[model samples]
Target: MTQRREAAIEKTDLTPLAGAETDVAPLGRQGLKPPHELTADEDVDVTQWNRVAAMDEFKSLVAEKRKFIIPATVFFIVFYFALPVLVGYAPKLMSVKVLGVVNLAYLFALSQFFVAWIIAALYVRAAGRFDEMARNIINRLKSGRE
Candidate 1:
């Protein structure tokens, strides 16, 4: 029973209703019937794998990417690279007299973490919203309506 069940699951139909007594019948083998290809009835169907559909998808992908790449590159340079350098180098020049007790470098270094947190928050929000907008535009264009 287990062997029959395994065979039924692994191989194509060999049940009694299929009129075949063997489950391991070789298709188009020597001295056997030939393997069949798709008949006439199945060839009349049409779908969107043609050249026009492929070109449309490629163009949509490119347009969606531009909405994200330019602004992100600018933000990465300013917040990640330029800001840190400015902080490290211009400590004395950009000192803040928060109070008589606290100096500018001390305040800046201490609040570096706050600046980092704000930048990260802005990035996450912009990324989520921008991706949604891009996807919506791309989907609209794909359907040939936008």
Candidate 2:
């Protein structure tokens, strides 16, 4: 068995597969260097990052993101868990008919999808502002004004 395995391994091609090159930019390239292509100098500078993190603008950016994220996360968690919780704890209340045969629970469950979409839309809108703030920071860094 060992000899047979060794013979099979010897017969197999050992050459590395060539990846198809494209003109398309690497995934998630918003003016950031591709991970695989970064050199020692291009790699993240801890001191620089620390300096930027200490900046009031960067601090505010972090706070702003946290403000949205924390509440959104909490709300999503509550909204998602509420369905099962309510159904389990308050069956009769959930069973009441709202529109023909559909109960309050069904409506509430269906509404979660819309709520998620609304949250996503809000985040998308908020992200545009966040991106602008980030761009401003990057510009400041590049212009040596930071």
On lDDT, the leading prediction is 2
lDDT of each: 0.56, 0.80
Give residue 62's error in model 1 in angstroms: 6.0
Would you list the clashing residue pairs of candidate 2?
none
* Model 2 lDDT, residue 81, Cα: 98
Q: How well is each residue in 82-118 modelled by candidate 2, as lDDT tens digits?
A: 9999999999999999999999999999999999999
Q: How far does residue 62 in candidate 2 sit from its true spot (Å)?
A: 0.3
TM-scores vs. true structure, each candidate? 0.36, 0.68
| Most accurate candidate by TM-score | 2
